[model samples]
Target: MKNKIIGVCPNCGANVVEREKGWFCENRECRFVLWKDNAFFKRLGKRLDYHVADKLLRDGRVRLKDCKSAKGKTYNATVLLSCEADGRSKFSLEFEGGC
Candidate 1:
């Protein structure tokens, strides 16, 4: 089966397609990608699933309702998506009331 088109590449304006291991920009020169088993999300006790990935690509942010802290406390936050100079994805969290 052919890969599904997920969104536009934030770096190169190419089509972002879903692959087995990750979502990737179709432009050969673009390094933009979102790995399914991303270490960043893993650290937050979350998997980078399709819904979150789609929202991040389309809106550059997604609200995570139950993020577990290292100490096992659950909290809600908005995850912001940004691109690095090399087209790699970078993420940060925004918490309510300066958490």
Candidate 2:
């Protein structure tokens, strides 16, 4: 099997590598945890379950919202996956109103 390095993690900002065991973050302290589970998903009206979230995380695909960095900057991010050491998740968003 062949693995590809996709660069650093977006959540923790640590290096991410594709290995035989699948993609794993280089940061030992980091779990590379993706989006929130049941409560969060329900609150956000996401049509996914806990099990699905886990699968998506493993597949490097999860969404994040209302994210604030360590620098105190807040952003409305639509991440396609949780591929960061900073603990950010990936998602696609829909804008209902004018910007």
Candidate 3:
């Protein structure tokens, strides 16, 4: 059967589907997910939405507006999608020339 394109996993190009809490990759090996309660986005008074998920899945990076800095400052920046050594996803802010 053909898998429906609900969403795409940013890591493995697998199908992603929305669950009660978030979106998850269908492949167990590719455990990429965008959690609604992600602390990073929560701090910014925002939640991970469909657009963010779609962009991260297709493009490896996404530009965000009004993101809160850990130091209690707010700014706009590009968030780069990366995978950790443990096969988990990691997000880091990218500045002018570096992360």
Candidate 4:
């Protein structure tokens, strides 16, 4: 089966590999990792957070205003995220790229 590679690393411009532990960027300088847990959730925001930023920084290849990687490629997009109805919580990437 073709593994659905979601996004790209925003740190070192490398592809992020999904592991049982979490996501990992295949870059020496970009050692980005994320897991699903309490502490992980605590370090995030309602709509978006550090985890989201980390994901974007480690697997989000974009070039927009509300985006992080603005030096790679220019694409119109509006990413939507969802998570527990709380303030400090890790959210999931719901929407990505429509324009």
31-66, model 2: which lDDT tens digit per residue?
A: 663333433444444545444444454555554555
Best by lDDT: 1
* Regions of model 1 farther than 4 Å from truth: none
The sequence of per-residue lDDT tens digits that candidate 1 reaches over residues 23-69 is: 99999998999999998888788999999899999999999888899
lDDT of 3 by residue, 1-99 (tens): 543456666677778877767777898987677786777667765677878767877787888887877687877877787776655678777765553
Model 3: lDDT of residue 68: 78
What does the lDDT read for residue 82 in candidate 4? 27
How do the candidates rank by lDDT, highest first? Answer: 1, 3, 2, 4
Top TM-score: which candidate number?
Answer: 1
lDDT of 4 by residue, 1-99 (tens): 643344565444566565555555566555544443324233232223344544454433212233323354433343332223321223333335434
| Model 2 residue 79 lDDT score | 31
Error of 4 at 20 (Å): 0.3
Off by over 4 Å in 3: 1-4, 96-99
Cα miss at 75, model 2 (Å)?
28
Q: What's model 2's overall lDDT?
A: 0.50
What is each predicted model's overall lDDT from 0 to 1?
Answer: 0.92, 0.50, 0.73, 0.41
- Model 2 error, position 67 (Å): 27
